[model samples]
Every structure is written in C-alpha cells, then in structure tokens.
Target: MKSNFRHIGLAKLCGWFGISRQAYYQYNWETISSTLEEEMVLMQVRDIRSRHRRMGTRKLYEILHPFLLENQIKIGRDGLFDLLSANHLLVRRRKRRIQTTNSYHRLRKYPNLIREMIPTAINQIWVSDITYWKLGEIHLYISFITDVYSHKIVGYHVG
Candidate 1:
C-alpha cells in the first residue's frame, strides 16, 4: 500500500486539503509542486490592481498579456476575469444619485423685478435674496446683497 504521506510536504498537502498544517506535517513527509506559477500570476495581478485600482479587466489584460506572453504563460481575458473575481480583486462601480428640482413645494412665488430693467451704472440698483441650508441638525439662512450695475456681490451674511 502507498503511504498517504510518501511524496509531499505535509504542511502544503494539508493546506490543499483544508486540514491542519501542524497536524499533517507532524506525521507526513510529502511535498507538492515547488513551482508556484499560478500563485505568482495572482500576486502580479494584485500588484497591478493596487497600482491602478480604477483599471478594468480589459486594461489589466492589456498590461499583463505582454509579460505573461513573454514568459510563455497561457491565459485568456475571461480566465483572468474569473481569477480576479475568485480572489475578490474585481473593481466595483458605485452609482451616484442624480439631483433634480422636485418643484413640489407649496410656497409663495415672486416676480422678477429686473426682467425689463437694465443697469447702466455701478450701484444703480441693489438686489438682495435669502436662502436656507441644513447644517447638521440645524437650519441656517444665508442672505446676499448684490449691485446690479456691476453684477458684483456687495455683502453677504449667514446664520
């Protein structure tokens, strides 16, 4: 009968079989392949991603293919994607919410006073307006004074 531990490092074999390395190495003297080409490829991929995290699979494939081909390594785009997914190296895109006017508030509307009036000199007329902002748990109001002649802001205050 062939001994289960005849030709492999016990620790590595245990790691492959999901067993305790200490327990297996204590009783066995077997070793797996010393060539870790696959592991090396994975590490390289991770390193590239760490440098250019925003890159997608196509970009990553383009960057890695030359190196891999030079080393005579055979891997396809899909294969690389699968490897990245398995290793949790795939980049995720976050979707941002689009903000638009709701036009649902029940408030009084005002008419535009400068619709027909055009400023011809500095300080000919001053326009003022107020707006509100929510800061933390408090609401604050901001007021601004502007010179319509020069179209410059004259004063502003926030509370």
Candidate 2:
C-alpha cells in the first residue's frame, strides 16, 4: 500500500489524508522532535532521581526547565508529567507513618479541652502539637505550643 502511494504526488497524498502538505511535514517534524525531547528529559530525570529518589514532578519540571533551555528542547509541566507517566518514571509518594503522638502509649490520653474553649486574649490558651520533620536521613520531632488567640508560636522544642 505504501509502495502504491509512492507514485502519487505529496499534495494529493496529504489531501487524501485530510491534511495539507505543510501540515504533514510539520506533524512529522513535531513527532520526531517530541520523541527526541522525551528521550533527553527521561535521561536527565533518571540522573537526578539517582541522588534524590523522592523528588516530585513540580521540582523535576523546574530542574528540567533550565536543562531544556540549554538543550533547545521545549516542554511544559503537563507534557513532562505525561512523558514521565508514560515511561513509568514518575515517582510515587510514600505514605510514611511517623508516630508523633503514640495512640497506644500506656499513659492516659488527655481530654480535648480546646474543643469547647475559645480564647479572647493572647496566651489564654496554648495549643500544643508534635510534628515530624525530615532533615537528611534523620527524622526530628518538633513539639510546639502556639497561642490560640494570637496564632503565634509561643515555644518550640525539636528532638
């Protein structure tokens, strides 16, 4: 079929395909360029992920932006996302459980006093919370007490 079509002119071939000759050439160029760009982006992504395994798509796009500019490649955030997704290169967010407040601790749990209480002034009620922070390979727990009225961090201790 391709051999038979070779006898016809390019204009007629494009016309039969419901496209202009210029469109056919343009589409061909775009496909080739996109494939090349995808390859380049994937290579860079793999290299970066080697060191930073948990990097998200937004950060990857930022890193790729300047690299793309240097390599004369053009791709948007969504395009990069789709490319990464299609290639199975997109990182999955891990649901890490950091036990800040142990529910099963032997100590008796305190009642929620703040549920019914409203603060009218600063330091009237200090709400305390424990949150985990990741610094390099170490996991640190931050215990903070915030003033309910002012919504300011009154005191914080990191362990």
**Candidate that would win on lDDT:** 2
lDDT of model 2, residue 39: 88
What are the lDDT figures for the candidates, one per model? 0.78, 0.88
Find the 10 residues in a row with the least total lDDT in model 2: 1-10
Clashes of each: 4, 0
- What lDDT, from 0 to 1, does candidate 2 have? 0.88
Expressed as tens digits, the lDDT of each residue in 1-159 for candidate 2 is 356444778998889889999999999999998888888889999999999999999999998788999998878999888988999988888898764555887887888978988888898899888888788999898899999899999999999
How good is model 1 by TM-score? Answer: 0.43
| Candidate No. with top TM-score | 2
Q: Candidate 1's residue-wise lDDT over 1-159, tens digit each? A: 777766877677778988897767644542332135456678888798788878888888898888888877677899888877877888897786555456578897788878899888898889997877766799788899999888799999998
